[model samples]
Target: MVAKSAKLTQLIQAVDGQKVHQIRCGDHRFIDVTIVQTQGRFFVRQYKFSKRSWYDAFINNPTIDGLPNGAMKIGDLEVQINGKVPEDLQSMTPSVNQAYRKLLGLVYPLMRLTFDRQKHEATTLELIPVFDH
Candidate 1:
């Protein structure tokens, strides 16, 4: 018989081992593969159940140059892995911000998977922008 626990170990384990990597795209662009911060690192790793792991990927750093113009991508998706949340997001490199906003859209499903904020608070301190991708 299964254990008398409401929690399954697989889900718990999956939520404990997510990962990401980074790489440089040509001269100015830096690429990344990041797990959402709210998910607790390694808790919801990308690729879910793919062959390669984060250790097998490139871990790029935050780019600030014209890198966004040439941001890295996998398949049809551009990686908008911002290493830091800038204090003034608008003052950010337009391209990177654009890239990030593009990425922000994709995170909706992932974000919904974890937490649902109170509508009011969620709307109030919103700083992240959206892109038309």
Candidate 2:
């Protein structure tokens, strides 16, 4: 299940304007990530497939101590994963690409390189506020 509308709003507001945040997985692991919001949905992309301990940890043990599979933290805000959102590799919107490039501050060739890397190697996951019970 996705977050309740109000909680989702709050979560989006909390993270608004922030490009990078720490994502906590398992009980004591945290990794710095760049978060992007497009169409009012939050996404985190793994730039390098080689460095995927965090992703591995989340997938292998998404939750601990009775938490949901999606339970995780972004910065100080608690959130849940909505699994991996499908990326339309062939049709990435300009705005979305721009958002990522801005967050990364990459120049022409580097931007192209990173974008290609993302297309070929990275995983994009949608994040939602933890559902309220």
Candidate 3:
């Protein structure tokens, strides 16, 4: 199992306590991420802000660098994107879809006017915590 940093542990606790909605990286970047823990394992979901899908980029090049270091690196962490896709594909819940809509609405009001459900499902990148073997 990969080790979880003290800072990350604290941040997770705070998030679970409903204290924060975003995570800060070592590069001093704040990303809106949803922390998920199941069966005693931790995971993170990162939203893609670019108009173009990162699916191709991630698939073509899995090794990633410049990961934000909030709890963990705070400025020195290189990560790999294990998997990425729209969250709706993972959880077919109306609420999740609605939440994505609301999030998009906040950024691009024009998106709220029309609904191309399949085309613009919120792009979510799923990161699994792992320790080097």
Which of the predicted structures, 1 or 2, would earn the higher TM-score when compared with the native? 2
Q: If ranked by TM-score, best first, what sequence of candidates would result?
A: 2, 3, 1
lDDT for predicted candidate 1 compared with the true structure? 0.31
Candidate 1 weakest lDDT stretch, 10 residues: 121-130
Q: Tell me the whole-model lDDT of each prediction, alpha carbons only.
A: 0.31, 0.58, 0.40
Task: List RMSD in Å for every model shown.
Answer: 17.5, 4.7, 7.6
lDDT (tens digit, per residue) of candidate 3 on 3-121: 56753464345434441244333334444454443322334333444543233344344434533212321223433224434344556334444444433446435643565544444
- The CA lDDT at 93 in model 3 is 33
> Candidate 2 — which pairs collide?
none
- Can you write out model 2's per-residue Cα lDDT over 1-133, one digit (the tens) per residue? 5447877777666656566666655455557776666667666666656655556555566444444445445556776554344455335445456667766675534846545754633455555444752
At residue 115, candidate 1 shows an lDDT of 46
Tell me, by lDDT, which candidate is best: 2
| Regions of candidate 2 where Cα sits further than 4 Å from its true position | 1-3, 59-67, 70-75, 87-95, 102-115, 118-122
Task: Residues 8-35, candidate 1: write the lDDT tens digits.
Answer: 3432233223323333333444435542
Candidate 3 regions exceeding 4 Å error are 1-53, 62-81, 86-110, 131-133
